[model samples]
Target: MPRIIVAEIDSAEQRAVAVDVWRAANAARRRTATEARIRRIQEKLDTAELALLAHYGPRPAGMLVAETYHVDGVPLPGYGHLSMVFVDPAVWGSHVGTEMIRDLQSRGWEGLSVWTRTDNRRAQRLYERTGFTDTSNRSTLRDGEEIMQLAWSLSET
Candidate 1:
């Protein structure tokens, strides 16, 4: 069985694991896993309200980042923004992502919101299956990738 651990986001070991998982999961769609990019991710993790790393025995398998504040341009209250969730491609169909979201929901958030690339249908399906609904709002990242916002009401859980 896999277990989740509260990550010390600023630690070198955790950061390296995060960057490795991210690169392995999204290398095709993202730029090379440069140190600068990993540093930026560490910065975000430092400010996040919650950061978790999932492990299957001794191997890192996934990560989740969440914040109490709403996502940019979103006006919702009592909602936690799920800033990031990434699972190793080797475990893509192993319920790792679902476990991460459930862990977040168990944190007492009234609701959860996330922004995902519009072209990432697999991620969309996963979120939808986990009870997130499309808010129909869209935004463009600095890299010009279009993103859609989705929200889940924890009250219904």
Candidate 2:
């Protein structure tokens, strides 16, 4: 089996690889990247407090993006919001997403939260396997798709 390497996206090479992975992984959103969506992905990567790339062997196959977990402009202590966890479609079943989530878990966070489209069962399964639970919290996206928040359980950490 090829090794999985996870690291901070710290250079132009790393950022480029991460973006490429994001491009290929946009299917996670159940759509291809429209020009506008591509732009939005770039914008998010630029602004995210932390960006990480995961390599399955030599290929950058996953990217994880995080920002301070906050509400109403107030930051939550020891908490983080994972804005994105993308695995290239080529590596869809390879546990790259699990490795990315575990990287965050190893950071000693009090909690981490992520939102997934309500209908994205594959992602929900990954989250569940990696120890995140549905908070029963929900919201509607701009496109009218519903999403639910999943929170990491302290006991699991």
Candidate 3:
């Protein structure tokens, strides 16, 4: 693998790359509504506090979207919440996510938090390697009761 470079996604074209990455990453899941998923991700991007894309060599390999960290609807000061994160399955085990997390850490913040599917042990390990800890807070996604796990990381930035 080539170097991982993280940058702000700047155009509709870049957003499309993000959508592609999401679809490819979740291909094994029981999801099929590509149009709806794209729309939903776009809506979230429109409001995201920060949206990033990671490139492995010249190909977009990952997407991360974060906003104000919140608990019980209250914003957590100096913290960012990752609402969406995905990496192209082709690049699994490649540290595209580690690069994205490094980018986030460079941004001045007290801490960052993210929610991952409980069954996604791969993502959990990545977060743990990047200094995130399980926060013991869990929730169901908008469409179902599939468990989601929360992890928090304090940034050296």
Top-lDDT candidate index = 2
**Model 2 whole-model lDDT (C-alpha atoms):** 0.87
- List where candidate 3 sits over 4 angstroms from the true fold: 142-148, 155-157
Predicted candidate 2 versus true structure: per-residue lDDT over 1-157, tens digit per residue = 8899998887767776778888776755567678887878777887778898998999889999987798899999888899988899888889999999888888867889999999989899999989999999999999999999999956665
Give the range where candidate 1 is weakest over 10 consecutive residues by summed lDDT.
1-10
User: Could you estimate the TM-score for every candidate?
Assistant: 0.83, 0.92, 0.87
User: For residues 3-88, could you state the per-residue lDDT of candidate 1 as single tens digits?
Assistant: 54444365658866876777778774665777887778877766667887776557788888888764467755677888888888
- The lDDT of each candidate is 0.79, 0.87, 0.82
lDDT of 1 at 125: 86
Superior candidate under TM-score, 2 versus 3: 2
Instruction: Give one clash count per candidate, in the order shown.
Output: 0, 0, 0
Quote the lDDT for 98 in model 1. Answer: 80
What is the TM-score ranking, best to worst? Answer: 2, 3, 1
Give model 2's TM-score versus the native structure: 0.92
Model 1 error, position 75 (Å): 9.6
